[model samples]
Target: MMLRQPCSWRMIIRTVTVIGLAIVTACASAPTRFYTLGTDAQPRITSSTASPSFRIEVRPVKVPTAVARSQLVVQINAAQVQVLEDDRWASSLPDEIRDALIARVNQQAGAPGAGTVAHGEDVPVYQIAVDVQRFESWPGSHVLIDVVWTVRTSADVETLTCHSAVREPVSDGYQALVGGHRRAIGVVAAQIAKVVRASAASATDSPLRFTGAAGKAAKGISCPHAADGAQAAADSAIAPLEE
Candidate 1:
C-alpha cells in the first residue's frame, strides 16, 4: 500500500497550469509579417509623349515628423493599429509616396504637352513645388494623401498654389499590401498631375487673355500697332513643357 503526499499533488497541478497558460498566450498573439514594394529596379514609363502647350516641373515631397514617428509599431497608439507583414513593416504607408510623385512628374516631362513633341528638352516655362501636408494611415487599412502645391511662372514670375487629398483602401495580408500600395500611389500621382496640369492651363490662359485684351484696347486708343510687341511677347512666352 502507498500514501499520496498533498505537497506532491499540488506541485503537479501547478506545472500543468503553467504549461496551459503558455499555449494560450502563443495562440492569442497575431502573426507579424514584413513587406516591400517597388524594388531597386528602375521605374518604368508606359508612354513617351505629351502635349507642348505648357511647361510643368515637379519637386520632391517633404514628409512631416509625426508621419515618420508613426511608422514604428512601438509608437502606434490605441487609435492606431499598424499592420506588419513578411518580417517587415507595411509598405502601404507614405514612405514611398514621394518617389511615386517623382515618377509621374518625370513621365509627364518626358511626354510632349498638347503643343510639342517630347525631345528631352525642358520646355516647361514654369516650375512647381509640392509640399505634402497630410500623409497617413487610415482606419480599415486605408491611407490618406494630402498636399499643397505652389506653381510659379518661369517666364512671368506669377504664382499660384493649390491643395488636394486622396484616400485609398488596402486589401488583406502582406502581398495585398504591396499591390494595394502600388494602386494607391498611381491614384495619388494622377491627382497631382491633374492639379499641375490645371495650373498650367490657368497660367497660360491668363497671359493669353491679357494679350488679347491689350490688342483690342490698342485699337480703341488708335494705337493698335503698339500692341504687336505685346502679342509677340505673349506668343514667345509659351515655354516647352519640361519632361
Candidate 2:
C-alpha cells in the first residue's frame, strides 16, 4: 500500500505563474513593421524616341555606420539618436538603395539595370556606384541625402565623381520621411541617367573622369543634420507601429 498525498499546490502555482508571465511578456513586446525604398513607385518612362543607353550596373551601395543597421535611424538632436527597432527596411538599406537607383535609372535611360556585379563579372557595361554620405530624416521637417557617386564604363573610357545633396520636405511622420527620401534618391538617379546617356552617345567632347578606383566601396559619414538641433525619441516610442 502506498500513501499518496494531494497534488502540490506550490508546484501548480509555480507553473501557472511562469505561463502567465510569458503571456504578459509576449503581449508587452512591440510589433515590428517593415518598409521598402519604393523601387517601383515612379511612373515608367515610355518613349518611342528614347535613346539607346549603355547597360548599367550598380555596385553595392555604401551607407553610414550610424544607419547601417536593420532598424530605422533618426537624428533627433546633436547628441541623441533614435534607433527604431519596430520599424525597419525590408532588405538591407544599402541593398534597397541600389535597387531603387537601378529602377529609376532604367526608367529614364531605357537601359536595363543589372544586379550587383560579382567578382570577375567585368561585364562590358557602364557601372554606377553610390556611397551615401548622409541620409537623415527630421520628422515634421525634412529628409536630406548626400551621396558621392561615380559612373564608369566597362570599356574604361570615362568616369565621373560628384557629390550631390537632395532635400525633400516631410509631413511629420516616418512614412512621410521615407517618401521624401525616395524622392531625393530619384533625383540622384535622374542625374546619373543624364550623365550615362551623354557618355554612351559620345555626345560630349570630354570623357568623364574622376580620381580613385571606380566601384570602390567606401565608408560613410554621420547624419547630415545631427548637429543641427533637438533629438527626437526613438521612432518606436514616437510612432505607432502597425501590426
Candidate 3:
C-alpha cells in the first residue's frame, strides 16, 4: 500500500479561501425582491357616461419613523426586529401607502379622476391627508395599521378627521405578510371613501357643517367599521419597538 501524504497548511488555507469566495459570490448573485402595496384586483369603479361628481387629491402620506426605511422590517420578537436586506419596497414606505390609498380610495369612492384639474373644474375636490401612527409587521402572526386620516375641501373651509385601525392575519411568508398589510390599507381606504361619500352627499343637501372649535370637526362622522363588527370581520383579519 502506498503511503498518503497529509495536506499542507498552505494548501488547506487556499482551499478554504476558494470555498469562502464561492459562498460570497453565490450570496452576491442572489436576486433581491421588490414588493408594492398596489394590488392586482380590478378597480371597483365602473364606467359611467354621467360626469363624475367630485375629485380627490391624496396628499403625501406620513409614516412612523421606525418603519420609514425601504427594507421590510419584521418583528422577530417583542424586544427585537429584523430588517430583510434582500426584500424591499418598490418605493418608500410613505409613497407606497399613499399610492395604495389613492388607488383604492378612488376605486371605492368611484372618483373618476384624482389630482386632475383638466376636467370637472366645477366639481368639489376633497384633499385626503393620512398620517400613519402605527405600521407593524410580524411574521407568522399578523399585520396591523393605525392611521389618522383627514378629509378637507379644497378651500379648507370644512375638515373631517377620522381614525382607523386594521389588523389582518397571515401565514408564514413575506408575501402573505405584505398582502395582510395591503388588505389593512384597503380597509382604511374604504373608511375614507365612506366618509367622502357621506360628505359629498351632505354638501349637496346643504352647506357643509362643522362642529367643535375652529370649524374643523365633522359631526356624526365615525369610522366605517366597528372594532368587532361586520366590517372588521370582512376586513379580518405586529410591531416591535413598543409601537
RMSD of 2: 10.5
lDDT of 2 by residue, 73-148 (tens): 8878867789998889999999889988878776555574344334455334778879999989788888899898
Root-mean-square deviation per candidate: 12.9, 10.5, 6.9
What lDDT score is found at residue 162 in candidate 2? Answer: 63
Candidate No. with top lDDT? 3
TM-score of each: 0.47, 0.69, 0.80
Give the alpha-carbon lDDT of every model.
Answer: 0.47, 0.67, 0.76
Ranking according to TM-score, highest score first: 3, 2, 1
Where does candidate 2 have its weakest 10-residue lDDT segment? Answer: 227-236
The residue-by-residue lDDT of candidate 1 on 147-243, one tens digit each, is: 6655454654434444556555765544554555444445544443443444455544454111222222111221112133223222322434334
lDDT of 2 at 86: 85
Which runs in model 3 stand beyond 4 Å of their true positions? 1-21, 46-49, 115-120, 212-221, 227-243
Give lDDT tens digits, candidate 3, residues 1-243.
999999999999999999999999998997899999986763454222256778888999999998999999999888788999999999999999999888877766767754544553687788899999989999999999989888887755556777788888999999999999988887788778777777777776665654513424355654456442225324423111111
Assess the local accuracy of residue 194 in candidate 1 as a C-alpha lDDT between 0 and 100.
43
Candidates, ranked, lDDT: 3, 2, 1
- Candidate 2, 4: how far from true, in Å? 28
